[model samples]
Target: MSFFPAVGVGVIGVLIGGVCLMSQRKSLFGALLSMEVFTLSVYIMIFSVVWFSGSLTSACLLFLSFGVCEAALGLSVLVSLVRSTGSDYVGSLVSGHF
Candidate 1:
């Protein structure tokens, strides 16, 4: 086991946890970006621990694909919400007649 990889994983874990906490006060777009940050941090941690083998390589690729897909889907939802609500903040999500 490498010392730097362990340190890097710890740093990324802290970043992921910080982003999760920060997302609560952010707008939809900001929250989605934070989520992407969190996912990328997880990917970094996984790569740090796992050697790239046949099955593991495929799994890593799939994991990366999902992260990208999630970002794109979140962005699309943000756009739709902005179009309907005229704002990106959480409190602007009210559904009744306004």
Candidate 2:
């Protein structure tokens, strides 16, 4: 119910998700999923803060902008990579020669 605990938990979740992403970078989908999870955790923290502090308008706007940009950028990069390499596995691209 307290803001501190909510923010703390969100930070922990984001950290854990980051670790997961770094450890699983060989897989494209895994990294994307981890990033999505991290983004969601951050959104949760922001929303919680907004709720407690009564700043929902700015927080929600920021969240929407960030979420849309993140999704678009991630998907676009993934699609381009896949199209160039003809594979969805990131490991293959790293080991390949241009």
Candidate 3:
């Protein structure tokens, strides 16, 4: 496996995930799914870097922390939104228009 290929994959994944996130911001599930994709891409990039460098303990730890934080915060917001609104429909959260 070459570093260039890994970098390319990571970049492409990030771009695709970002587009999904931006395009579906109106939907809570879509936003969560997009964030998951983005996080997976970041994990892939970190793993590739570790593979090439032969040391990734620190990177892996950071990745774990990042994942935990992302999941926690995302779920918290989702839960709060549902509790306040009594529904998980992302469209309802929007004020003006969809």
Q: Which structure among the candidates has the greatest TM-score?
A: 3
The TM-scores, one per candidate, come to: 0.74, 0.77, 0.79
Model 3: per-residue lDDT, tens digit, 2-91?
887987788889999999999984668778888888888888788888889887578777886888799889998888888877776786
Model 1 C-alpha RMSD to native: 3.3
Per-model CA lDDT versus the true structure:
0.72, 0.82, 0.82
**Residue 97's lDDT in candidate 1:** 26
- The better-scoring model by lDDT among 1 and 2 is 2
Error at 8, model 1, angstroms: 3.3
Determine which window of 10 residues in candidate 2 has minimal summed lDDT.
89-98
- lDDT by residue for model 1 (73-95), tens: 99888888778888888787666
In candidate 3, residue 64 scores what lDDT? Answer: 69
Please estimate how well model 3 matches the true structure, expressed as its whole-model Cα lDDT: 0.82
lDDT score, candidate 2 = 0.82
Q: Which residue pairs in candidate 3 collide?
A: none
Q: What would the per-residue lDDT of candidate 2 be over residues 1-98, giving only the tens digit for each residue?
A: 67899888889889988998889957677788888889888987888888889765776778868887988898888888888888778767755552
After best superposition, candidate 1 residue 68: deviation in angstroms? 0.9
